[model samples]
Target: MTPTLGFFAWIIIGGLAGWIASKIKGTDAQQGLLANIIVGIIGGFLGGWILSLIGFDVAGGGLIFSLVTCVIGAVILLTILQAIRSKK
Candidate 1:
């Protein structure tokens, strides 16, 4: 499964997760496809890290879990960015 879920899978999952997150965060209008993909991948990493800190087993989680993690992280990331931008 690991081998099958390669770079392309990451991109697909990230893109979808990011798109959903952007919509959820109400920032979809401000982002492009590339941005979504980037955010999603980064968000996935961030989410995994955060969940791991709280003793969540993120690694063994399946596709849906991974997508949820990515979406959660993307929303958090977007919220932080929005807050920072608003302060400016």
Candidate 2:
């Protein structure tokens, strides 16, 4: 089934995913709402791409799966970001 999402849907997904990412990466207080949204959106793209590459299709739900996938990706991204930042 094809999923139909609206602007608010995206916001919800981004917020939840980003929050989860921040909590996982121990950066919840450091990153604000806007930053979370941005990271979450980017993480969504990254997650979807990675899933597709592995032959996994994730485009059915409204913001459930999307949020979960994005959170996972965001966590990974944040981890990488932290690692990189630590080196500098």
- Per TM-score, the best of the predicted structures is 1
Regions more than 4 Å wrong, model 1: 1-5
lDDT string, candidate 2, 39-66, tens digits: 8877887887777678776776446777
lDDT of 2 at 88: 100
User: Which lDDT tens digits does candidate 1 get at residues 1-88?
Assistant: 1222579988998899899999999999999999999999888888888888888888788888889988988888888899999999
**lDDT score for candidate 1 against the true structure:** 0.86
> TM-score for each prediction?
0.92, 0.87
Model 1 clashing residue pairs (backbone):
none
RMSD of each: 2.6, 2.5
Candidate 2 residue pairs in clash (backbone atoms < 3 Å): none
lDDT of each: 0.86, 0.79
Report the C-alpha displacement of residue 63, candidate 1, in angstroms: 0.8
